[model samples]
Target: MSILAALTPAPTTNETEWSVGDLAAALRRTLEDAFGHVRLRGEISGYRGQHGSGHAYFSLKDGTARIDAVVWKGTFNRLRQKPKEGLEVVATGRITTFAGKSSYQIVIESLEPAGIGAWMALLEERKRVLAAEGLFAPEAKRPIPYLPGVVGIVTSPTGAVIRDILHRLEDRFPRHVLVWPVRVQGEGAAEEVAAAIRGFNALTPGGPIPRPDLLIVARGGGSIEDLWAFNEEVVVRAAFAGTIPLISAVGHETDTTLIDHVSDRRAPTPTGAAEMAVPVRTDLMAQVDDLARRQGGAILRKLERERTDLRALLRAMPDADAFLAAKRQRLDLAEARLRPALAGNAGAYRARFGQVIERLSRHPPALALARARARLAAIDHRPRTAMVHGLARRADAVAALGRLLGSLGYRAVLARGYALVRDEDGLPLRGVAGLAPGQRLRVEFADGTATVRTEDGGPLAGTEPAPRTPRRAPRRAAKPADPAGAGTGEAAGEAAAGDPARGRRAAKAEGAPEDTPAARQGSLF
Candidate 1:
C-alpha cells in the first residue's frame, strides 16, 4: 500500500458518536502531521500572491491531477526566486486538510523554478520584437560627449551597479552625477526604472537636481530574469523618449538588453559609460590655447602684410615728376604769350633779346635741364633702391618664416629625417592611437614616396638615426572652446597648486575631488 494509503483512517466504528466538526478537525491535524516535510514535483496551474502579505496561493498539477498549495509569508520570503503560473517546480511542503471547508491544501516550505524553456522563448520573442524596431541597430547609436556637464544614472540604489558607477565617476569625471534610483529587476522594476528616467527628463521646478546632459542606464550583470527590467517596454520607451541622451550600460560586454537598443549609445560596462562621458580636462585646455594662439598669429600676419603693401606703394609713387610737370606746362604758355607782345619793338626787342641771349648763353637753360635731370635721376634711384631694399627685406622675412616653420616640426620630412605616412585618402598617421600594426600605409617625403608597413613595436628604426636637433615647439592646436580646460600642462599645474582646499570642499559636496584636469583646463581656456 502507498504511504498516503496507509495514512487513511482505520475502519470507522459504525456511526461513531462524534460531531462532524470535531472529527474532521482531528483528521486534519493527523494528516498535517503525517505529511509534514514531504516533497512534491508538479507544474503550476494557478498562482496568486497576496497584495498586503508575502503569501502565495497556487495549484500544483500534473497532466491528470491537481493539488492546492499555499506558500506562507515566511516561506515565500525565503524563496530564491519568483514563481509564475505554468512553471515546473519541485515543491517541499506538508498536506493540510481544512476541517470546516472539507478541502485539502499543501503548506509549502520551499519551492524552486524548473524547466523554463517556454519563459526563455517568451524572452527571445520579446527581444526579436524590440530588435525589429531598430532598437538594436548599431548605426542608431551615438557616442557620449567626452566630459559632460551632468550624468543621469538609473539603477537600483542598493545594488552593486550603483556603487560601481559612483566609484568610477568619482575616479573619472567627478562631476555632477544625479541618480534616479529604482528597482533593476522583477515585477514592477520596469515601471520603476521607466518612471525614474521620465523624472530625470522632466527635471521639474524646485527639483533637487538639474537635468543631466547624458543618462547612464546601468546594472550589474545577471540572469535574463534578473535583467528583465531593462528588457521591459516601459524602460525601453523611457530611454528612447527621454530628452537627455542615454547610455545603456546595463551589464557586461556580452550582455545586451532592450534598454541598450533604445538608448542613444551602448557602453559595455558602467565604468565605460563613465569614461565616455568626460574628457581629460588637461587635453581640452591645451586645444583651446592652441586655437587662440593661431588666431592671434593670423591676425598679426594679416596686419603686417597690409602695412608692407602700403609702404611699397608709397615708395613707388612719382611725387617729384608730377609736381614738375604742372610747373613746366605753365611756363610754356607764358613763353607763347611773350612771343606775341614782342612784335612792335622787334628791332629794339631783337637788340635787347640779343643782349639777353648773350646773358642766357652765360647761364644757359641746359643748366636747369641738367638740374631737373639730376632730380629725376635721384627720384628714380630712390624708388628703385627702396624697391630693392623691400625685396631683400621680404626675402629675409620669407627665410625666417621657413626657419620658424621648420622648427615647428614641418621640415623633418624635407630633410629626410622623417616621413609622413598616410592612408589612401591622404590622412596622415600622426599617432598609432587607433591603427593596427601591419596595416598598409603611404609614406611621403620631400624627395620621394614609399609605401611602408606599421611594425608591431613603438616607433620604427630605419637605416640610420638622424641627429637630434632642438626645434621650437609648434603653436598649440586650437579648438572652439578650451575642452573645459583639459589637456594642458600649465592648467594642471595651476590646479595642483591651488585646488587643495577647494578639492576637499568639492569632495564633500559632490563625492568628487576638485581641480580635475579637464575642469582645470576649462578654467584656463
Candidate 2:
C-alpha cells in the first residue's frame, strides 16, 4: 500500500449529519441525569414572569459566572414574601441543558432568601409601611402585666420552639398556656397569623371564648423567609390592633422582624417570650420569706431597746431617804479630809488660851497706877519742893532745847524783834540780781510789818519777776529735853515772837537763792 493509502480511510458518498440542537439536547439529558438534585446560590437578575401560571424566570450570576433559574407555580405558591430586585437567594434545583434552544437553565424546586442584606430590605420596607399606620408606636403596643393569669401562644405546635417555651415557662413560671397553632410560612401564612390574633381578640369579655391576659406569637429558627410571615403587613397590623398584649418571638437570637418592633414586647426566641410572660414561683417564695424576717427583726430590736432603757431608769431612781443620807455622808467626807490638821493642834489651842488669860490678869494698867501712887506718897511733903524741883529741871531742859532748836532753824531768830525783807509783793528779794533799787517791798516781822525799797538794776529791772525763795521753816515748837519741861521752854517763847526780817537779810547775802521761778498771778505785783 502507498503511504497515503495506509493513513487515509475510504470516503462514503452519503452520511447523516446531526444539527446543533440535536447535539445540545443529547448533552442536556446527560446533565439532567447527573445533577437533577443540585442547588445553586447567586444574585437574581433579568427576572421575567409568566402571566397567570405564577412561573418566574431569572438568571443567577456572579462576577465572572452565570446560570439561568426558574421557579414554577408550585414553588411560587409556597413563598410567603415575594422577591425583589437585587435580592440574594438560594435556588435548589438541577442544572440541565436545553438542547433545542442550545441553552442551560436551572430547574429550581424551592427558593429562599440568602443573606442579611435581603432580609434587612424586607424588614425596612415592612417597618416603613407599618410605622405610618402606628403599628410600631408606643400607643399601639399594649403593656404586659407583671404576672399574667393566662397566656395565649401562636406558634407551630410540633416544633422545638413550642416545647422549649413550654418547658421554660413551667420550670421558671407555672402560668397556663393555650396554644393557637398555625402555619408559620408559605402562601396564606400572613392571613393565618392575622386570623389567629383576631380570634384571640374576639374571645375577650362578652363573647363565647375565654380571654387571655397576654398573647405570645412565636416560632423556631430558619432563613429570613421562614420568619417573613411575622414581617408581613397583615401580621404587624393585627399585632398592633389586637386587644391583648402580644409578644413576638421569631427566628434565632440575631433575627428581627416588623412584628417584633410593633408588638408589646420582643423576645430573641420563643423560650425567651415564655420566660417574660410570668414570674418564677421559687423567687416569689424567697421574697415572701425575706419580708417576714425583716419585719420580725425590726419589731424584736425595738422591744429589746425599750427593755434596756426601762431597766436603766429603775436603777437610776432616788428613794425618799436619799436626801437626808446624802447630806450626812457629805458632812462625814468633809471631816475626814480635815481630821489630820485638827488632831495635831487640839491640845495646843487649849493651852495657849489659858496663858493669855493669866497674862491679862497680872499685867493690868490699874495695878501699875497703884504702885506709882505709893511711890509718890513716900516722897517728902513740901509744896515748894515739887514746884522748884519741877521748875529747875524744866529750866535746864528748856535751855538745852533752845540751843538745839536754834541750830535746827532760824525761825526763833526771826521771832526776836526782826522783820523779813521782800519785794513789793510778799515775795522775798533774796539777791541783787533780781532786785530794783526803787521797788518797794514789805518787811514782815513777828510783831509788825514794814515796807522796804528794792535796789534798782538787776534781772528784776529788765524782765519779769524772779522766783520766790522758800524759807519754809515749820512753826512747830521743838521738843524739850525732859518730858516735864516742854511747856516752859525758851524755844516756845521764841516761836511765839514771829519776827522774820533778820532771817531774810542773812539769807540774801548768802549767794543767789536756789528757788523755783514764781508762777504768774492773776493780780498785778
Candidate 3:
C-alpha cells in the first residue's frame, strides 16, 4: 500500500461523508463515551461569579495547560464547596464536547478541595478576605442582651444540639425560643443556615412572630467536614451583619470555626450557648429578695435613729407653762395700767376741747367761712355768666354766617326759578357767544337738569319772537347789580340788581351763575 493509503482508514458504508455539525456531534458522543466519569485536579481560573442563569462558567487550569469547565445550575446550587478563583479542587464529572463552541469542556457534577492542605489554604484565604472587610473585627461585635425575650436558634431540628440547648435553657431560664430549622451538614446546608439567620433578623418586632433579641447558631460535635457549613462565608456574613446578638456553638470545644470569630459570643457547646443567653431565674429572684431585705432593714434603722434624736430634743426643751409664766405676768401689768392711762387721756382731750372752743368763740370761723363762700360764689357766677354770653354770641354769629352761605349755595338757588347753563366740559357758560347750532348745553332748572341744543344758533333756540310796539324813544333796560363782596358790606358805585318783572321773563342772562362756587356749605343738614 502507498504511505497515504496506509495512514488513512477506509470509510465505512454507514459513514460516507460527514457535515460539520454531524462530525462535531460524533466527536462529542465519542468523548462522552470515552470519559464518562473522571477526577480532575486543577486550580480554578477566570471565575468572576455565577451567571444570571445560575450556571457557573470557568476554567480548570494546570501550570501549563487549561480546559473549559461548567457547572449546571442544579449541580452548582447543591455543591458543598462552591468554586472560587485560584482554588485547587478535585472536580468529578464527565468530559464532553460542546458542538456550538467547537470546544471540549468538563461538566462538573461535584467538586471539593483536593486535600487537607488545599482546604486549609482556601479557608485561610477566605478568612483573610473577610477579615480585611472587617467582618471579624472585635469592635463590630455586639453585646449579648442580658435577658432576651426571644431566642432564635439556627440548627437542625432533629439533632441533639437543639435538645441539649432546650434542656439547658429550661434549667437556667425559660425563654420564648424560635427554632429556625436548617440542615446542619451536607449539600446546600450553608445556604439554609445563612438564610435562617437572616430570616430571623428580617422579622418585624412585635409582629405575629416576634423578632428575636438573641441568635444561637448551634450544632453537635462533628468532623471538620460536617461542621463546614457554619464556617461558610455566607453564614459568617449573615451572623456579622445581623442586628441580633449571635452566639456560635459549632463542633466540640477544640474545633474553632469562622462563625465563632465573627459571632458576638462563642460557646464551647450547645448547652453553653443556652446558659450564656440568660441567667438563672431563681438566683435572680433570690438576689432581689435579699436586696429588698437589706433596704428594709436600713430604713427601719434610720427610723429608729430619728426617733431617738427626737426624744433627746424633747427632753432638753423647757416645760410649756414655765415658758409662758413671764408672758402672763407682763399681760397683768399692762391690764392694770390701761384704765388709769385711759382716764388721763380723757382729761387731756377735755382740756384741749375747751381751749379750741374758747378760740372759736373769740373769732367765729362760720362768719369768715360765710364771707369766703360768698366771694367764691360770686367769682364762680361771674365766669359762668361771661362764658354763657360769649358762647351765645358765638352761636348767633355762626347762625348768621350759615344763613348768608345758604343764600349763596346752589342747592337753594336751584329751588328758586333760576336755571344754570353749563358747557359740555362742566364750566359755566357766562355769555351767549358760544351758543351754536347743534351745540349741547346743560340747563339746570329748579327741579332737575335738562340737556338742550340750539337749532337756529340763537338764545331763543326754538321760539319765534312776537313783534313789540315800536317805542317813541328806545329806553335802555336796566342792568343787573353785583352783590357786595365779602367784608365790604356794600356794593360801591353799582346799583342793586333789581328783580326781573313778574309779568315778563328774559331768555338768558350773562355773567351770572345760578349760585356761587362754594359747594354744599349749608346743604349738609
Candidate 4:
C-alpha cells in the first residue's frame, strides 16, 4: 500500500460530512470534553478588559507555548485577584472554541497567583494601592467601644467561629449580639462579608434590627488561600469606611490579612474579639461597691468631726442667768449714786439764781424797775422748768452710762466670743509679747476656765507645755542709805579724786547721786 493511502482511512459510504459551522461546533464540543477543567501556570501577557462590557481578554505565555484566555464580565468582576500583564499566575477554567475566530481559548472561571512569591507580590501591590489613599493610616483607625450594647458579627453562622465568639461573650459578659450570616471563604466570600458590613451600617439607629455600636468580622484559622477573602480590597475598604468600630478576628494569631490593618481593633481569635467587646460584669460591680463604701466612710468621718467641734463650743459658753444678775446689781448701784449727785447740783444752782434776783432788786431805777418786772414775769416758771429738764438730762445720762458700762464688762466681751488669758501671776495678758513658750496660763471663757500652755511662743487651747529654756536671773538694784547725807560728801569727794569705781559704789549705796557713768564723769569734771 502507498504511504498516502495508508494514512487516509476509507470513508464510510453512509457517513455525513460536516459543514464549516458544524465542524467548528463539533471542535468546540471536543475541546470542552477533553479539557472541561484545567489549570495553567504562566506569566500573563496582552491583558485588556472591555470597559463597557467588563470582560477581560488576556494571553498566558511561557518559554514553550502561549494560549489565549477569556474571562466573562461576571467572572472578571467576581475575581479576588485580577489578572495583570507580566504577573505569573495560574488560570483555572475550561477550554472552549471560539466559532467566529475558529480558535481554542481558555474561558477562565477563576485565576490566582501561581506560588507563595507570586501571591505575596499581588498582596503587596494591592496593599500599596489602598495604603496610598490613606486607608491604612493609624489616624484613620477608630477606637473600639469598651462596652457595646449590640455587637454585629459578620461570619459564617454554622462555623465554630461564631460559636466561639458567643461562648466567650457569655463567659465574660453577656451582650446582645446580632449575627449577619456570610461565607467565610471561597468564591464570593469577600462580597458577602463586604455587603454584610454595609448593610449593618445602612440600618437606621432605632430600626427593628437595632444598629450595632460595634462590628466583629471573624473566621476560624485557615491557610492563606482560605483566608484570602479577608485580604480582598472589598472587605478591607468596607471595614475602613464603616462608621461603627470593627474588630477583625480572621485567623490564628500568626495569620494576618488586609482587613486586620483597616479594622479598629485586631483579635487573634474570635474568642479574643468577644473578650475585647465588653468588660467583666463582676469586676465592674466590685468597683462600684468599693466606691460606695469609701463615700460612706468619708461622710461619717465628717459628721463625727463636726460633732466634736460643737461639743467643745458648747462647753465654752457662759451661764446666761448669772451674767445678767451681775449686770442688774451694777445698774442698781449706779442709780443710787446718780440720784444724790443730781439733788446736790440742783440745790447749788437754785441758790445761785436767788442771789442774782436779789441783786437785781437792789439796783431798781424807774426804767430798770419796769424791765425787772417784765423779767420777773418771764422767769416765774423758768427755775422750776430748768430744774425739771436738768433732772431729765441726768437720768438720760445715767441710763447711757449704764449701757456703756454693760458693753465694756468682761461678761459681755466673753459672751461675744472673747476669752481672758491670765498668766501664772494671775495678771491678764494684754499683748502677744508677754507670752512665752512652755509657760502655763489660765484661759477663762464665759462659762468655764481651762488650764492651757504656750506653744511656739503663743498660747494654745491644750494641756501640753512646750519645751523649756533656761530661766534668766533677776536684776538687783542698789539700796539707799539713811536720808541723813552721811555718805553724800564722801562719795562726791572720792569721785572727784579719781577713785571712780569706789565712788560709784558709795554713791549707789548712799543714794547721794545716780551711779550713771555720765553723772560720775560730771562730778569728776
Alpha carbon lDDT of each predicted model: 0.69, 0.72, 0.80, 0.80
Model 2, runs deviating above 4 Å? 1-10, 13-25, 48-54, 97-100, 171-173, 182-195, 202-209, 220-229, 251-254, 268-271, 280-525
Candidate 1, 1-525: lDDT as tens digits: 799899998886777687898888888888877776788888887676654676788889998888898887876765644567777877877888876578898888866555457446556777788788876677766666666777888887886788877787776547888887787766567888889888888986345767687888888888765776787676877777777778888878998777877788788998887777776455667888999999999999999999999999999887987979999999999998887767756878789989998989998899989999999987986888899999987776566445434433434323433455676677764454455678777766657777766666344455432333433222222332222333233322332344544223322222222232222212211
lDDT of 2 by residue, 1-525 (tens): 699898999887676687877777778888888777876778888875554667887789878899877777887766654545567877777788765557889977776677778677767876887678766778666779988877899887887888998899899878877889899987677889899998888884645556889999988888776777888787877887788988889888898888888888999988889888987889988998999999999999999999999999978887658857989899999999788768768868888998988897988878999989998887747766899899987777677555545533434434543345666656754445655568776766556676656445465435765545565432434333344333333344343344444233323223223232221111123
- Global Cα lDDT for candidate 4: 0.80
Q: Backbone collision count in every prediction?
A: 22, 16, 1, 2
Q: After superposition, how far is residue 265 of candidate 1 from its true place, in Å?
A: 2.0
Q: What is the C-alpha RMSD of each candidate to the true structure, in Å?
A: 45.3, 20.6, 15.7, 30.3
Report residue 120 deviation for candidate 4 (angstroms).
1.8
Index of the highest-TM-score prediction: 4
Ranking by TM-score: 4, 3, 2, 1
Provide the lowest-lDDT 10-residue window in model 1: 516-525
Pairwise lDDT winner, candidates 1 and 4: 4
Better TM-score candidate (2, 3): 3
Q: What would you estimate as the lDDT of candidate 2?
A: 0.72
| CA deviation > 4 Å runs, candidate 4 | 1-31, 51-54, 97-104, 307-525
What does candidate 3's lDDT look like per residue over 1-525, in tens digits?
A: 699899999876864898999899999999999889999999999998999999999999998999999999999978878898888999999999988889999999999898778877877888999999999888998999999999999999996889999998898999999999999888789999999999999999989998999999999887776788887898888888889999999988998889999999999999999999999999999999999999999999999999999999999998899989999999999999999999999999999999999999988999889999999987987888899999987776566445445544565556655557777888866555557778887777667878878565544657554433422211234443323241112211111223322101121111123223221211211
